[model samples]
Target: MAKFPKNFLWGGATSANQIEGTFLEQGKGWSTADIDKFIPKEQRKSGPADNLVKRADVEFAMHDKKGIYPKRNGIDFYHHYKEDIALLAEAGFKMFRISISWPRIFPNGDDKEPNEEGLRFYDKVFDECRKKKIEPLVTLSHFEMPLNLVLKQNGWLSRKTVDDFVHYADVVFNRYKNKVRYWITFNEINVLEMSGFTSGGILADNIANRKEARYQAAHHQFVASALAVKKCHEIIPNASIGAMIARFESYPKTCNPKDALANVRANQNNLFFSDVQIRGYYPSYIKRFFKDNDIHLKINDGDKKILREGTADFLAFSYYSSMVAISPDATEGEKLTSGNLKLSFQNPYLRSNDWGWQFDPIGLRIALNELYDRYQVPLFVVENGLGAKDKLSKDNRIHDDYRIDYLKQHIEQIGEAYQDGVEIMGYLIWGCIDLVSASSCEMSKRYGIVYVDLDDYGKGTLKRKKKDSYYWYKKVVESNGLIL
Candidate 1:
């Protein structure tokens, strides 16, 4: 096997809310996830509604609670950062992709002054990563917004949220400007529209009207992202700031041109966030889509200038599986929803993960090739992994050959993309440790190479057990490629 670039990043990915679970500890107040206690259902208000059992679920059920579901303490990454980082280091990670909790930093979304305790927590976290000589790629916002800001100011639907986001980003950039080099302004910024308020951590009632609210909220975020990019350069002139999008591999449902056209349109819209961020402007197709739909955005003075000047240095995205989108007239069948997309199981031919994200390793190569052709910027795959249900035998060993198979095939495609002149930056698999799933907020959808014993009901000791994939991944990373 050939070696990857001398400095290529090989790491696992995680988010503050999903892994670091001191939701209200230290100076941290209730974030948007904490405010979810009143949402009444799962999937929240964004792409999919998710009722992640609040603290009340751990004791007395709330009015909108769905029985006694798992409590919000996910995998205890907040308390276990050192142990987990050691595991990641053992896997030979050159870099570690992680995000900071907004509420942890700001406590309140609109706060100009950051909480010293909140900032200090990350000080330790990043310092630990740097101690291990692992580069830290930090995300400013990852689906977590302070609830007070959302309820009081009406969330991202208002332009005020954009300014608040800039302030929030500034707080972290100034503190960790020297420690972290790679910064992603938003995580899956486009999903705020596809899944509606659910993806952005905003409540459904806050949306008021789903369609209009989605477009309006996304408009605010796009501008906010542009401003973040611009401010990042001002603060850390040499920082590599990129926009993170959930890049889906779109496939046509049929050989017919009609199906092909529909598939292309879907990809264009689904992947259009990058067009705006990378190109620093909306694409022609996006303008046409808005005109045809009569969806107008609230663009103010200098917003275009911010986007144009704040274009990202590169593109970092998450790819788990491809979706087969059919045209309106084509013969419709089941949809693939098993792997990471977790939409609906509409495609019948493909197999999927327990959570319904379709499994397609070939899609990774296609996604890489396509992004290179269109954007012509360096690409970094920040998140890609298989989430499954792993069982522990009496001997306490987990035989997770399924996960090894999934990663092996994807690594093969990564090799193909690298050899094909894709200028691939790095590959960070999702949930290096067994953390909560961002979609359903469940532990059953396991993605970690190292397994955690906790379940959806929150039973068992939060033990970290190395699965079979752990040893396999260590070798893969040590070799800089798959050993096969």
Candidate 2:
């Protein structure tokens, strides 16, 4: 019955930009997330092809009136914080995973002073969470940068961005030191390597040699993350700061060693982010990777010391599903499949959602066991959920048994992983309430157990209602995960 810890945290997670609307209110300035426009099916060049953001798109989004920018006016969590927290608490949630918008505090990312109104807003949020006995798992940055930084500083591509981020981290760490205890330095830090503009705001098309810019920006982030960890420890004194990444663990396409080797290298490419944050140094494999790829990163003075000394206290990751890896030489006529952030050969044995995200709940157990064995630190499943379309019946109810099944199966794998001796921290389902989709920028790809009556075009009553999964999750959390 003790499959999960007595103190196991059962909760739902959402980033500020994803859930909070009123992007410019409370003294909050615009951020990178504010610029993401929803692309209709007809307009999409390909599946997530618009992932590579360009400077022109950024420029257009700033002034474009016709585009449907959902993030700018998310589910309105900005004004509904109390009500939303109440709903989550009513479902017996012990934790509420949320992120503080960096631009909200420092409008320009390098502002000499923080916007007091922005800090005051989260004060009420944390207070409500405290009143409801819901712990706040705060992420420092979640795919958001100040628009000013993107335009002027080139996001994380400039080392100066590191100092700006550290100062912002320090401000929040000191301000929320008492209100919040859990911290994640960056959400999906590895995304910078591939989706530079989205993750780091480098404006992908402007870079001539993208590989060099990506790593150089990644190096800056590595230093900033480490420095943030160090500052968190110095200021919070009792808080646990960790690193977060988009965890993509894949299998080889065939029994061939070539496929296996390709899979190993690909996994390392993703794991390299956490290695620097958790292990406090670069893996030996990365030296060959940089040299072979002709990517040179500028590592300045004392950066290594900061990394070595400021290792994360834990590892947080998002694992929605696993992919199959095949050697480039073996790509004869194999069908390719889309995944979280990578493409690979689709596995015939797996079933996919409407978004083509293959489901392998059993893969969750395998991933947890591997991560625990590798790092031996407490691991948190910060983001894992099925994004499927939900229907609202006329009775003012949403019978989303599909979502209940998705969560139940994944929770089962988590239990198996716990029995296998993984030091599990907790599980937080992504998008606990329906909000803008991070990849496609659509609200229809709902992942929440609680339904938000908003559509892709941002038309809705804006009312919140519980889905069938909500009561199901209440029982699971009430029993400390034993009921499931």
Candidate 3:
């Protein structure tokens, strides 16, 4: 058995939008997540497209009164933190990664003062973690940006949002300076390109030039992230802030030079966010991308200095599967898998989950090496897990050996990566407790060691049950990856 370092963090990852319900409770305003309607599996598509009709449908659904808004009542985590944290402590969690909802604190994104009730809520949550000897890995913004920002300021597309985000960061950094040492500026900042509205609150469908709007919004987010890093360091002593990206490792479809070149460009395009956040500057390759796409980024004078000075302390990312990129002339009709907010060509060598996400534990090892070699910084696997449909047996036990096997394989790969000289900080499985799915917005796409008794239509007992993998994971954590 490969042994991890003594201080390696073992826990799970969840975001406020996915898990923390009470969207309109305790002075919290509506977030973009609050307005995101549940799209049926058949209605989903490969990539983002400009559709004003769909955007209007979403807006209409927001006020339809009978529309099913799943996020509005996320696993009811607002009322179950103590119970959930106790379960996590039982699993021997050394650290727990969760996001602080922007709207929860600010109500509106441009607020002069934060809501006291929202502040007190996290105060109790963080204090509970302290009681259980669990360190909280906090993300400043997770997809739950206040909808007010999007409506009033056009989301991150406008430079004014940079100051609003900084104000929110300043408040939280000062308040939780002592509780949280591990901070992430943004969750999957790279998703701003594909899912601009959900990730950064830029409504791609509403913009005339979708590419220009998305890239401009991404630049604003980059500056905001850098400013947050600077503020986090200034306010919180001994804080280590990182940038989180959705990592989609790509491989050439074949040995053809065109395929290889296409793969390289795809990887570079996906890696653009980390390049700026970690390397402290934009890559030169983006110049070609900008010119070819007719995209012009609006940059201010001191923005460069801010980005240079606020390089992230480390790099954290979520890796679910690897993708295969082919040349434009390559044949179609290949099997497809969903991941990282994009549809990718399925790898014939890998298995897949019910959600059509490819299973590739070895890809994790490959990703760790590539990221480490590129930046030479400590890497944290903050989100990695299988989303499956589990059945409650007659004996009231979830015999989810499949889930255990999935995690076991991934952890073993992490061990291999560690032996290969990667500086891995931790492995936090996605959704320690069952919560709403971020992409599908369905509770049925379950991924958790501790299962929550919630149905897809938001009707269940809300009971917490431990699956077989829960005990298995507890043992793995207690042994620090040796038991697996």
lDDT of each: 0.77, 0.89, 0.88
Model 2, 1-484: lDDT tens digits are 5468889999999998899999788888889999888889677765433445677878999999998999999999998999999999999999999999998999989999999999999999999999999999999999998999988878889999999999999899889989999999889999887788788888776677787898898889989999998889889889998999988878998899999999999889889999888899889999998898888888998989989998999999998888888898988898877778666678999988887788889999999999999999999999999898888889968898878888889999999999999999999989999889987789999999889989999999899988988899999999988887
How much is the lDDT of residue 147 in candidate 3? Answer: 83
Global Cα lDDT for candidate 1: 0.77
Cα deviation at 229, candidate 1, in Å, is 1.4
Query: What TM-score does candidate 1 reach?
Result: 0.91
Question: Could you tell me how far off, in angstroms, the CA of residue 221 lies in candidate 1 after the best superposition?
Answer: 1.2
List the candidate 3 regions with Cα displacement exceeding 4 Å.
Answer: 42-58
Question: Sorted on TM-score, highest at the top, how do the candidates line up?
Answer: 2, 3, 1
Worst 10 residues of 1 by lDDT: 51-60
TM-score-wise, the better of 1 and 3 is: 3
Least well predicted 10-residue stretch by lDDT in candidate 3? 46-55
Expressed as tens digits, the lDDT of each residue in 1-484 for candidate 3 is 6779999999999999888888689999878888767767787665533222234654675687876789988988899999999999999999999899989899988989999999999999999999999999999988878888877877898899999999999999999998999999999888877777777677545577787888898899899999999999889869999999999989999999999999999989889999999999999999999999999989999989999999999999998888999998884777667775678887889888887788889999999999999999999999998898988999989999999999999999999999999999999999879889887788888899988988878899899999999999999999888897
